[model samples]
Target chain A: MKLVPTIRYNVQDIITKTIPVYYGVFTLIFLTLFSMSKLTSLYMAGSFSGASFNSTVLIVVIGFVYTRSSFRYLTQMGVSKRTQITGKVISILLISAVAVVMDRLLELFAEFLFKSTEMTYEGSGIAFSLFDAYLSKLGPVAREMTLIGLGYTSRVMLLSATVFIAMLYVRMNTAAKVIVSVGIPVLAFVGMPALAMLIPEQMAKLIHTIAEITGLSNGLPIRSILWMTGGTVIFMMLYSLITRRAPIKD
Target chain B: MSSLELIGISKSFGNVKALDDINLTFEEGKIYGLLGRNGAGKTTMLKIIYEMLFPNSGAVHMDGHAIGGNDTALGKMFFIGEKNYFPEEMKVEKAFRLMNDFRKDFDPAYANRLADAFGLNIKKKIKSLSTGYASIFKNILALASNAPFILLDEPVLGLDANHRDMFYKFMIEKYSESPFTAIISTHLIEEVADVVEHVVIIRNGCIIRDEPRESLLDSGYSVSGKADTVRAFVSGREVLGTDALGGFETAYVLGECPKNDLPEGLEISRMDLQRLFIQLTNS
Candidate 1:
């Protein structure tokens, strides 16, 4: 009945669980890369992109754990399933936005540090955020907009994958769980690619068409944002269908 | 007064029926002890009432409104189960704060005081707690929740003697301060016998007894003496069970003791709740 507290609690939970690890790993990687730049003549680049990638991974993990962990805890607290699922959706969006902002901040921080310190070093440096790495040709405003779109799309895609897997795992028996746990990755990494080999041209065309429609091929991700938003809704509906009457298992 | 009712509730896992066509009601402002043997569906029934499990037929209602996915109705009840549901990395105090966030009446001060009384370090992560401490932590949360209905499944599962004693004391203190409905489902019937005002015994997924504690206890009496004397005294009476050791015997009989007609050799005593439960639910 009270949506705000549920959403607030879930957001706090996700942030408390993942954000610290994100920042810790970011600091470690940044320092490691900075020290390497100081010791060698090689140009150090792509640090911000690496941070963004890590954030995406963290979001994906959050999707799975939110269902596995928060769902159980909240249910025990007498939160209805609808409230839990709604909290989860809103929490994902909020945390994903936070991750995007953190990515942008990390980019700025890295750029300032590298550029100011380049005069003292033997090697030059460039800190390319995901946007710079992928869409450097876009103007300043377009680049920022594309970054927002890219962040939303990447998080939605990963969240869909992990939430689908986690929900199916929750609803399944031991044997089905084991099979699914082993089957999904194999299907994605080996089976799909292998099947694609039998129809390389069609697969290639499909990929290209997807990229074109999403505007990623043209260095703009505006359409991808709308498409991924739609994808998120569909994934959320599937999550609800799976969990509406689902009982908590041991 | 508010009441929680289960009408024709049934649940099954594969071929095993955990609960079957059961109807029950829990009235407000009273303590109820749900007595059942292992696999007698105490946990399953409680879970279904808490909406953690869905029943195959019928539904749970609070004040005549279906509680299936209704947040307002669900929010009125808080359930603490044997397993830890808090995030493993969450600290005890943080959990208290989170509870406060969710339940408007949650008393953080009371929870902290209870934590101090239990010697539970507020900073310790839930995963680091030993078995007894985990139970204590969950119990403390339930006691401080201030929800109208609190369901505890195996609330004393891992508690030692002293802590269990302290918990019962605190539970009574809290309930006296503000009366709320509590349904405590546990295997340790004796420990809760004095605390529960009402008793419900489940056997083979069906409720065989549900009544006030005094009435349930009054339905049986035990006689102990020499084997032959005890048997002779209980002869023609409704016998629930008997235990014999060497020349001594104790016969559990289903009826009030005729206090004035006590035989010379046999000693008559009120049957304890544990013995009654064991006799009634024994296969």
Candidate 2:
């Protein structure tokens, strides 16, 4: 199908589009925070205990904003929903991969070039580690990359699916749009706690199954692939169901 | 040949019924003027055909198959909607290229030529263009699209007199050379009266009149003279509407004109499309 090449092109477009927006916003934010931290370090010991940019969150937010703003425009240009779904999935994956690479490079540059120490906080205890510690402990570079790549890929896949699902209601009336925009996050946040309380036994059973399937190092890859595939199907169905008869509006 | 058939199409927004039981057919290679009053479901109908909005209860058929998620059917029809659906940041030239990419039949060269004729700067961002220029930008794309069917809703909106004239001329010129179906929904009935080959007059949410332009023009006429004479002449005929100026009266009548020429000062003239539209849709 033409979807293959169309998706390839859309992925390039999404990647091309994100770098400028992400870098521009992140640069301004990072510079402002860096200045504030340096000034604070004058009096206190350490304000910047290695700034851990939650780049996974960053990728998700980027996906959300892009899909929200561009879906109508893209569809109007004759891009089918199937192509859109496939393209977005590929784009989100590529974007997450790019972010991981950039993040790692920044970490290495900060450590080797600037001699900065990275820190891990275990509850109240703080432990220092070099940039190389992750690679050394994870195993061979190729295996470590597979595990880490799967982790990021799964996060991007789930997030992109979620963003697409939320955006499906964008053409609905103002009330529906608002409910979707505000309601989803509230539900997601509250649902976690609510689900735990409502179905303790079932939740424990599900966790046990997940744990059994994903035995830490040995099963992480399978778990990652499962989440990625599961998220894609679930969100695609949700989006198609709601938008099956949606009236396109400004 | 190709045609678009709307079978029992109906749409409603809340309690407001935008379209009701609209079953219409738009055939190939002719200009169709869809004349309707404001809020008469013109835009809604056009949007449904292009898949921008789905009808509440019925389907749009292209050729023989019902359209559903099939871009190929819609790809044959290009919708020139009133709203600017293109990305605000996209350049005008970029929009043309994108349209070309979507439809292989879209002529980028012809688009640029149309842009030049309209004096539009294709390099300018879509949002940066003035309202008139924005309409021109979209018009250029539609003109160059070369799709088998094109639905234009208020195509000349925001256009000045000169641009409007130019557009009409270009539309006719293009049609003569290479014929394509055009369903034009516009309030400016007089402007498109001579251009459209067929006429579809909609009132409220119902089809009031559907005929060829020649049949429509020949079907109705006006008789003006003294009030008494005009009334006597129009009596027993289908009076669409009447206008009075002091003692002078003119009655717009439908079907046919009286051939008897015995009246001393009674004057008869063909009812223009604009006047016919006004009377037919005047509630």
Which candidate tops lDDT? Answer: 1
Error of 1 at B97 (Å): 1.6
Give residue B205's error in model 2 in angstroms.
2.1
**Candidates' C-alpha lDDT:** 0.83, 0.73
* Predicted candidate 2 versus true structure: per-residue lDDT over A7-88, tens digit per residue: 5544555567666565556555555545554555543223333334435556666656666545666556555555565665
| TM-score of chain A in every predicted structure | 0.80, 0.62
RMSD to truth, every model: 4.0, 4.8
Give the clashing pairs for model 1: none
DockQ of 1: 0.68
Model 2 chain B: ten consecutive residues of lowest lDDT: B255-264
Lowest lDDT block of 10, candidate 2 chain A: A121-130
lDDT string for model 1 (A1-250, tens) is: 7688888877775677568777667667666777777788887654233444346677767777776877788888889988887877777678878876766666565555566444322111212322244556778797677666676566766676678678878889999988887898999999889979999999899989987876556544566677777777888788888878878888
Question: For model 1 chain A, where is the 10-residue window of minimal lDDT?
Answer: A121-130
**What would the per-residue lDDT of candidate 1 be over residues B96-173, giving only the tens digit for each residue?**
888888889899999999999999999999999999999999999999999899999999988999999999999999
